[model samples]
Target: MPATGRENHTAPKAVYIHIPFCTNKCFYCDFNSYVLKDQPVMDYLRALDREMELTVRETPPGEIKTIFVGGGTPTVLNPQEMEFFLNSVKKNFPNWAEDIEFTMEANPGTTDRDKLAVMKAGGVNRVSFGVQAFQNELLSGIGRIHNTDDVYRSLENARNAGLDNLSIDLMFGLPNQTVEMLDYSVSKALELGLTHYSIYSLKVEENTLFHTLFQKNQLPLPSEEDELKMYQLLMDRMQAAGYKQYEISNFAKPGFESRHNMTYWRNEDYYGLGAGAHGYVNRRRHMNIKGVNPYVEAAMQKLPRLEQFSVPEAEAMEDFVMVGLRMLDGIRSADFAAQFGVSLEETFGRELHKMLSSGLLEEHEDRGGYRLTGKGVVFGNEVFAEFIGVLT
Candidate 1:
């Protein structure tokens, strides 16, 4: 796949590439990732390169505005492997926006100075580190390999490599965590003065170590009230530090909002490549094969799809509302009308009236849309749940 002059401006503008190799799996993670030892790393990268070649031939990309490389810790790749993978991206998706937001996810201890330099030279301008907790005990409790010192060292490496758009993820509601502990974590995180922060509450997903411990009542998670307090404290602290809550769990300095994630909230199209990645484009969604060997074998001959389906119109409309409500700015009524050829009220009048009456939603003061109220923000799952079966 060489650079081409023809540009399909309406094609998918966002790309999500998954690297499924991790040094160790976290206790709470159920994502399709595996331990890196003895894994066929080069074979998988070559297969991903083939997938990209086939993907753009099927749906030629526009001037790509955002490209996100997610993982099992993408920074785990050595400098040589990193260079090859990034070169494959540039070859397939040749037309890039001048100010494209190319981001890679990293684990704190995994990113060294030399690897960070390779990432920057490969056109990665942003990095998001998975610094789940500030406390060493909590970090170990969650099976994270990195400590507080590693977080600072990784951030320094990123900056030294000339990649300054940085973000760190902090978790609340961890096993044996307290509100004060969360407050301390947020305070330490804010002290870094990074460009963005993502604060997430822990969810004990099935098949994870946490879930197994939880089933036996072994995980000492914070109580609901303490978790709620943690959420409130983090929000207040982030606001005081001048970071805007652009989405439910994401906060950023002005103009530092994650454009790649915004593509999902806006219900736009994107290419999902690599093992176990799910992509949405042209109203169709597909998930690639989950196993490394299977994905590599399949991609050499075809798209390596494990499953594919076209989203029904009714479900697409419901998705538009569900994901759009995640952003603080909310969904514009005109955008919905333009996409569906019907007013938002005409399609979801009953549901809208119910939520509006309950005070979970409010009309946008300066825009033609509706946004979540404070109460709605806290109980977002309940609000999003209302849209699911209503469309079906």
Candidate 2:
């Protein structure tokens, strides 16, 4: 079998770089990103390079297995800037594994042929297009500047640039979204025959336009029953079409599961670079400074860390359960013991007994692990909550 992952990590094998520039902010997005019209793009890139230099000097990475460049639309960079940035990444993370899954998040409208070419030459083998909806009006209402036309154009450009590992994002439970509308959108997505698909429910986050509208009863959202129906329909359709539900919201073909995302769910260590990025290493978690100039200036002198804290043992235990349960295969008791040095039953026997008796969890058939039952998936929050604060 190919090397899946190591049980213990001495250094980060996965890396995440954040690009915080976007042409426009989506109404439902609350991520740490900025609109790019008047931002200091070049200076930020230089500072990013400096930060990576300092970080690698302190704690160099192993052969990088995964590198995910997420953004406020990483494809917003021009060809020249993209080339410079990718070169800096190569310089810092010098050693890469044989099967490095280098992914760059792109907005559908931002990636032209030239930009796609730069990304391919820079070692980016996978591209995830943020095509939230296929409907033009819904796209406009959600504050995305791209339409269905740009989605096709961007994918064509990516393919032309020699990239076939492509994925697209879709959102359900959106404003004015009916079950029928979601059905139509899913049908359009499945027709494309992409390797991976991520369908997420919209959450009204604070400081977003959607939140303001929702407060004033201006945002028209699907009813609770309708949203549930959309979720069920999507699960059924994806499974029928032979896409595996590898995670709660992700579906992919065999061997095409997102290695970078699995790193997070498996609680692996990774390096985080750029403004407002978060990372966990050496049993501590850190978030970088959020403001653009502040991060740039700080990176010049030192690492641009705004907050860092050592995770206590009990809290780490809770995090293991919360993060691991997101995977449908669930957490293995032996793997848990290998990481935390305690048996799963000994640590959470009370909680496990309760969850098992209530039919929220059951022993996974092929492995000695516990996974969510069908009812548990719907009420997953309740199950996760039971594990939290139980040990800590």
Best by lDDT: 1
Question: What is residue 155's positional error in candidate 2, in angstroms?
Answer: 0.9
RMSD to the hidden true structure, all candidates: 4.1, 2.9
Residues 2-22, candidate 2: write the lDDT tens digits. Answer: 222233448899999999999
Off by over 4 Å in 2: 1-9
Model 2: per-residue Cα lDDT at residue 177: 87
Model 1 stretches astray by more than 4 angstroms: 1-9
Q: What's the lDDT of the predicted structure labeled candidate 2?
A: 0.91
**Per-prediction count of colliding residue pairs?**
0, 0
lDDT of 1 by residue, 125-212 (tens): 9999999999999999999999999999889988999989999999999998999999899989999999999999999999999999
State the weakest 10-residue window (summed lDDT) of model 1: 1-10
Clashing pairs in 2: none
